[model samples]
Target: MQQTAYLPLALALAGMLLSGPVLAHSEQHAAQHSAAIVKEQKPWGIAGEPGQVSRTIEIGMSDQMRFSPDQLEVMQGETIRFVHRNQGKLLHEFVLGTQADLDAHAALMAKFPGMQHDEPYMAHVAPGQSGEIIWTFNRAGEFDFACLIAGHYQAGMVGRIRVLTN
Candidate 1:
């Protein structure tokens, strides 16, 4: 009779304990959303509107550490929707930024290989999955996009983007 009375209390305590981890996970996801908003306002370019897209480009990633048509050219002020397809058997990402930014991010990724983060200019694509990122080339300069998945970057999984003036 005493054991039965304690059962409800025990289950209640267990439920509370389990909810702590779930709450933490939710907070982490919220943080990622905030970071993405911050990224959208940064100098690389504002988040492009789908209706304003000047062109659409399809890019493919493979386990061989290569991107199809790895080099791209766009005019300044052009908005592009990049359709990224992962053909690899492993996890891949498409991150767009300058060489310096990519190098910094890659170094950080190497240190925390299991870290999960997102930005407006980044897409995390799984094997045989597709992802999209809409970006505008507001500045006239050279930029880079790469998969900064630990050893993936070291294996030469990088591409170039050049924004030229009209």
Candidate 2:
């Protein structure tokens, strides 16, 4: 019959139209996955805009109850590369937050392993070991970094971070 005669032509036209968009979509998806793989291999960082001002600083914590430099000053909204080295016999945490925040969190820390050192904002460095953290203190305030190893902070192991006005 006349209707059945156009079956082959209709099928061919439908396949051609579908293939065009399908091929383009598959190629775009492949490119996106490739780009994501490259990003995963990079170092620790605070996400920011292009050409943003930033700097890296090395901080060391020791058993002697101290953080090297004692006090740190940074510009508001600037990135800080924190490299923490623990030269102490016990585990140490390089936490950045207000003094009250540290104190409040300290009590609940014993529930977790490594003193919550595995947080994205902190890198727990064991004795004689090294690690890094990327922190951006976007506001001007006083933050205290301490090794809340029970008696550590009480023995004066706390340090100060001063983020300057914008």
> What is the per-residue lDDT of model 1 for residues 1-166, given as tens digits with 9 covering 90 to 100?
8999999999999878866655664567569777644434545676787899999999999999999979999999999999999998999999998888999889877865766676779898999999998888888888899999999999999999888999
Q: Which stretches of candidate 2 lie over 4 Å from their true place?
A: 1-53, 110-117
Ten contiguous residues with the weakest lDDT in model 2: 36-45
List model 2 lDDT by residue over 41-156, tens digit each: 11222333334538878888888888897798888778777788888887777766667867865654533323222444556678899887666666676777877766677788
Model 2: number of backbone collisions: 0
Model 1, residue pairs in steric clash: none
Q: Looking at candidate 1, what is the lDDT of residue 63?
A: 96
Task: List CA RMSD, all candidates.
Answer: 9.0, 17.0
Clashes of each: 0, 0
- lDDT on C-alpha atoms for all candidate structures: 0.86, 0.67
